[model samples]
Target: MSSPRFAVAQLDEITPTPCPCGQARRAFKEPWNTLATVHLTDIHADSKAHYHQKMTEIYIVLEGEGHLEADGQIIPLKPMTTVMIRPGCVHRAVGKLKIINVPMPPFDPADEFEV
Candidate 1:
């Protein structure tokens, strides 16, 4: 027998964890999988700026109005806005927001650094 070619995640059943942005519900994560993982993050008003060493992240805003602070540059954002953050770029989302984040190479806590 062969393993299933796909995996499914019930995000609501997942526990939320404190992250730099706010709280996050990470799904579709596996140690053997090195491609990517997805997270549902709630952006807090005081989201902290951070960066990843090698992982690339794509942020898709699902709700709220705000801006993306990337290396001191402010990029306005709204619902449905998408931004691709590359490795080593310090970034953070401002204001109240709900977003879906896709992290390439999966999300590694050890790779995240506060800026």
Candidate 2:
């Protein structure tokens, strides 16, 4: 038998975890597959400002309205709005939103820093 070259994850089956932005269900989080990870996040009102040193996060708003505060700038957001946040940029989402976030180089719990 040959080993599968790709990995599959059921996003709905993945458990949601508390994150800086809200609750998130992440997929493709294996250490060996470190290229990227996909996250479905439900943004709450109390999202915190945080930065990642080695990961670049791309956020795509799937529902609701909001604004992204990134490096002292506020960017308005709505459904279909996309924002790419680079390493070292302190950012957070305000307002109710459901977003799909893709973290390049994958996401590391240790790399997240609160600012």
Candidate 3:
């Protein structure tokens, strides 16, 4: 019999993004259409406001405090807080924030939409 397509793991794999702010991805390719465990570290809100064309995302605070602006509303966030971002939703996090970002369809820089 063939082994399962996916293997067990103690920790997920992480890939870094090319932005002024720090961005890392934790997800697998192919068959699986969803992406997960993106870490956004020490970045300004304006630096992260770019949108994704084929993906939706959620941001959960791991450390520090900040504000999330989504759909024209400002929502205050602290440790353990989470915010859901729909595809094409204009959103950004303010202040020095460390967050866990999860995106569906994975994140492709070519698919990003800039405001």
Candidate 4:
């Protein structure tokens, strides 16, 4: 057997998992790729404020309008809006939204901290 150099993930085929946000379909979560990971997130009105100690996340809004609360600052969000969140920045999405999240250095559950 040979190791594959590339991987593919179908967004719709991926199961949505519960997170601080509403639900998320994550791709490239395997240990083979530690540089980055991608997620399709459906944000809920009650998304909790949280931060990552090691990962930096880039969020690109895909649907609906909302606001991104970062470090107590409210930033409006809309379709195509993009936000880059650094480590330790307390943040959460308010209102219903769909976004594509790209996490650098990958995402680790242990690094997630509630604010």
Instruction: Give me the candidate number with maximum TM-score.
Output: 4
Query: Could you give candidate 2's per-residue lDDT for residues 15-95 as a string of tens digits?
Result: 999998889999998767858999999998959999999999999999999799999999999999999999999999999
Candidate 3 collision pairs:
none
Ranking by lDDT: 2, 4, 1, 3
The all-Cα superposition gives candidate 2 an RMSD in Å to the true structure of 1.9
lDDT measured at residue 17 in model 4 versus the true structure, 0 to 100 = 91
TM-score, per-candidate, Cα-based: 0.93, 0.93, 0.71, 0.94
In candidate 4, which residue ranges exceed 4 Å CA deviation? 1-3
lDDT of 3 at 85: 84
Model 2 clashing-pair count:
0
lDDT (Cα, tens digit) per residue for candidate 4, span 1-115: 5546898999878999988988999999887786888999999776989999899999999999989999989999999999999998999999999999999988788988988
The parts of candidate 2 lying over 4 Å away from their true place are 1-3
How much lDDT does candidate 2 score? 0.92
For this target, which candidate reaches the highest lDDT against the unseen true structure?
A: 2
| TM-score quality measure for candidate 4 | 0.94
**Candidate 2, after superposition: displacement of residue 2 in Å?**
10
Instruction: Give the per-residue lDDT of model 1 (tens digit) for 1-115.
Output: 4545799998767899999999999997776677899999988786888999999999999999999999889999899999999999999889899999999989999999998
The better-scoring model by TM-score among 2 and 3 is 2
User: lDDT for model 1, on a 0 to 1 scale?
Assistant: 0.91
3 or 4, greater by TM-score: 4
